[model samples]
Target: MRFDTRLVHAGHELAEGTGDVVPPLHLASTYAHGVQDPPAYFYARGENPTREALERALAALEDVRFATVFASGQAAGATALATLAGAGRVIVSDDVYGGTYALLTSSRLDVRPVDLADPAAVADAFADPWAAEALVWVETPTNPMLKVADLAEVCRRAHARGCLVLVDNTLAGPALQQPLRWGADVTLCSTTKSVAGHLDVLGGALVHDRADLHDLFTTHRTTTGSVPSPFDSFLVHRGLKTLSLRTARQVETAGKLASALRESPHVAEVRYPGLPGHPGHEVAARQMSGFGSVVAFRYRADVAGLLRRSRYFADAVSLGGVRSLAQCPATTTHRPIPPDVRLRLGITDDLVRLSVGIEDPEDLLEDLLQALSPS
Candidate 1:
């Protein structure tokens, strides 16, 4: 079946007890076990019916063998990285996404920062002396900057070196891009964003094509005890039903906003894959079905003053929600990383990451213009 059709009817069926159209939420923490041996579910930590149903649906959506839901995106990321790295191993990653960066640096795992957009640099990093037991973690159309990485090339190189490849599919979400199809061993996503749509729940998931990796992630889920609650899982499933529709509208709005920002005198630069002249436009066009909902732009004048004057764009954290949000990465998201390091990664002080919502295009444009203009 097509993606949109699958989204609405993939994992849900009529309830056995009431014949309800929606899947019933099993909130009980523990399930009854038989005398000899229990069925698939024994306890909430291990599995629950509601969570399992959502997991199966997500796996089907991503075309993966298994899917494990987590309490948050960071938990899923940590679990996947820990499973791949084991212990006392190096991880090569692009200097993006503050939460992921914190996890990599805080843990005992050794991390090597590299320019993911350049395949040659990634290859060199993998061949370096510190790469003895290394894994490659990539985030395409990377956070804040919207820099696109060549996933297929990187996966080929990493696999050739007997290394695991983990791609964070949060920014593009599974509706637009699937990393496993590009040869990635595992795909990670923060359902709190586009997948949840409503911004009402915080959740994460890991999908993989390999059975061994799937089993390993499942083991990690059980040991780490970071599985999502039954209600959160249900909400994620409900949000998934409208994923394609919401994303399609968001894409259209983001494209218009990016184009308008580029033409405005108060904007220094607009970074969006959907834009014709964006550096990674070709790569994104090849890999993703849609250009996604996020757009980043730099201010030509007083950034602080403009933000203060802005009425519609809320200066807030997190993206991929139904509400539009504007954030200053240098101060909010990427503050933990050094200033020089952020600059090296092409994340500037004036950069404003805009998460376009399903709002009217004209209203959003007017708000932006008023904010950019001097009061």
Candidate 2:
């Protein structure tokens, strides 16, 4: 099945009793099971019918064999590292989500940041003794900065060094790109953002093709208790039905907004893979079906004023909601990073990150134009 068709129908198998079109939310904490007959699901923490359904759909969308849902994006990310990478050295993209940076740096693991977009830098990282049996953490079209990593090249280098690669597929989601298709061992996504669509639910997912890795993640999740609630799983699964449609609208709005922002004198630079001048434009074009919905740019005018003047966009953290959102990453998402490091990554105070929603293109464009205009 195609992406959208799989989204709507993959997990919607009719129950023998009710024959409901949607997957029923199984809220049972524990199932009735006897020693003589073992059930597939015995407890909510270990297994949930609703979560299983959602995982099936998620796996189908990514064209992977297995998927595990989590309570939150951070939970999934932390679990991926703890279960797979452990105390071993981990090489991550220098420009990544603030939560990711915090989680890695605060952990006992030897976490090193490398420019994953640069093939030479990645090769050099793998050359080091520390890279032996190491894990590579990559974020393509990286958070806030919009830097795209060459996934295939990095994965090849990591595997050659007997290392594993985990690609954060949150920004692009399965609608735009699938990292496992590019040879990544695992793909992590914050289903809270794009997958859930609405701002209501918080969830995360890990998709991969390896059966052994799937077993490890499943065991870890059961032992550590990081599974999502049945209702959240249902919500995310429901959101999947409209994933392609919503993503298409968002990409259209974002592309228009990026082009318009680039023409404005108030903008210093625009960073969207769809933009011809963006460093990762060619790479993103090659890897992704769409450039995604988020747009990052350096604003020359009062960053505070532009945020305050916006009517359609809410100045907030997190992205990929049905509602448009905007924020200065230096102060919001990437604030956990040190001042110098943020500057080095080009996440300056004037850098405005906009998460375009499924709004009318003309309205979003006008809103940005008026917000960036002089008073």
Candidate 3:
């Protein structure tokens, strides 16, 4: 079956008692395991029916055999990275989410920040003999930057060097891209984003192709107690049903916005994989079936004027929500990082990132036109 078709059907079993079409949420903290037939669910921390249903659906979406859920994307990412503890080194993308950068740098592993998008640069990062045991963390259509990484190349080189590769598929979402098929050992995503769609729930997911790695992540998740609640899991399960349609609408709007923004004289630069001039356009086209909603562009003039004049977008931080959002990454999302680090990353004060929504394309375009009139 096609992806959209499978999305609606996969991992969904009829509710046992009432024969409900959707899987019923099981909220029990602990389940009874009979002597005659032991139930698969035992405890909330170890496992839960609601969370398992979401995990199974996620696993199927990413074409993987196993998946685990977490309270937040950070928890999922941290737990997945923790699996590389005691390894000689870990390589991370320089422009990844600020939270991810903090988690890796402060950890026991020698985290090395590099441009994982550049296969050669990543290969050079592991030049040292100890790096043979390294782990690589990547993000394509990276946070705020909208840069696409060559996950396939990174996975190929890492696997050849006997290193594990974990690709954060948050920005593109599994609806657009699947890193595992590109040879990545594992895939990470913030289900809170496009997966949950409504912005009402927060959740994270880790998908692994290898059994041993899946077991390792499950153990870490259980030990650290970083799993998501049953209710949140249930919400995300419902969200998955509309992910395809929501993402498609948002992606279309984003493409139009990126094009319109480029025509404005106030805009200095536009960063979007869908843009022809973008460095990663070809790579993104090769790996992803669709370009995501988020768009980043540089506005040399005062952003406060732009923000105030805007009538539609909420001046907010989070992305992949049903409503449009706009934010200055330097002040909001990447504020934790030093000014110099952000500058080097091209996250300037004048830069604005837009998370386009499922709203009408004309409405969003008019909002941008009026708000950006001064630009």
Candidate 4:
């Protein structure tokens, strides 16, 4: 079946007993055992019919053997890293996505941040003597900056050293790019963002082609009790039905916004892989079916003043929702990192990351123009 059809019908087997068209929510914490041995579900932490259905659907969508859902994106990321890396093992990652940086750096785990734009730097980071058992975690069209990484090459180099490669596909959802197909062992995402699309629920997921890794992550999830509620799982599945349509609208709006920002006087640099002059444009075009919905740009003047003047774009946190969001990363998201590190990664105080919504493109453009205009 095609992607859109799969999105709606993949894991949903209509109720055999009740003939319910929509999947029913299994709310019980524990399931009754009919016989001496027990049913598939014993406890909520271990399993639920609704959550399992969603997991199976996501695994099918990503073309992976297995998938596991988590309470949040960070939980999925941390679990994947923790399950893969042991004591003193190193992690090489891009200094993008504030939540990821916080998880890697603040945790007891050893990590080395690298400039993802430079493939040589990444290769060198892996070659360092301290990285003997390293795992490479990449976020392509990386958060805030939208920098692209050559996934196939990175995976090849990392695998040569026996290091696992995991890609955070939150920015470019499974609809746009599939990291496992490009050679990543694991692909993780904050389903709350693009997959859920409504911003009403919080969920995370990990999809893996390797059965061993999938089993390990699934074990970790059950033991750790980081699984999402059945209601959340049902909501995400409902949201998945329209993922393609919403993403198409988001991509269109983002392109319009990127062009508008580039031509504006207050804007100094527009960082979007879709833009022709963007450093990673060609690489993004090669890997992704469509450039994602997020765009980041820096201003020539007072960023706070500009954000304050906006009516349409909310100065908010989180991305990939149906409503537009604008945020200053230097203060809101990337503030945990040192100023110098953020500067090196091109996350400046004047920068604004915009999560373009499914709203009318002309309305978005008008709101942005007013926001960027001098207050």
lDDT of each candidate versus the true structure? 0.85, 0.91, 0.86, 0.86
Candidate with the larger TM-score of 1 and 2: 2
Native-referenced Cα lDDT, model 1 = 0.85
Off by over 4 Å in 1: 34-38, 127-133
TM-score of 2: 0.98
* Candidate 3 TM-score over all chains jointly: 0.96
**Winning candidate number (lDDT):** 2
Clashing pairs in 3: none
Best by TM-score: 2
Poorest lDDT segment (10 consecutive residues) of candidate 3: 33-42
lDDT of 1 by residue, 236-334 (tens): 999988999899989999999999999998888899999989878998999999999999998977778877887777888888888888988989988
lDDT, candidate 1, at 28: 88
lDDT tens string, model 3, 276-373? 99999999999998889999999868998898888889998888989999989888888887889899989889999999989899999999988987
lDDT comparison, 2 vs 3, better candidate: 2
- Sorting all predicted structures by TM-score, with the top scorer first, yields 2, 3, 4, 1
- Where model 2 places Cα greater than 4 Å from the true spot, the runs are 35-37
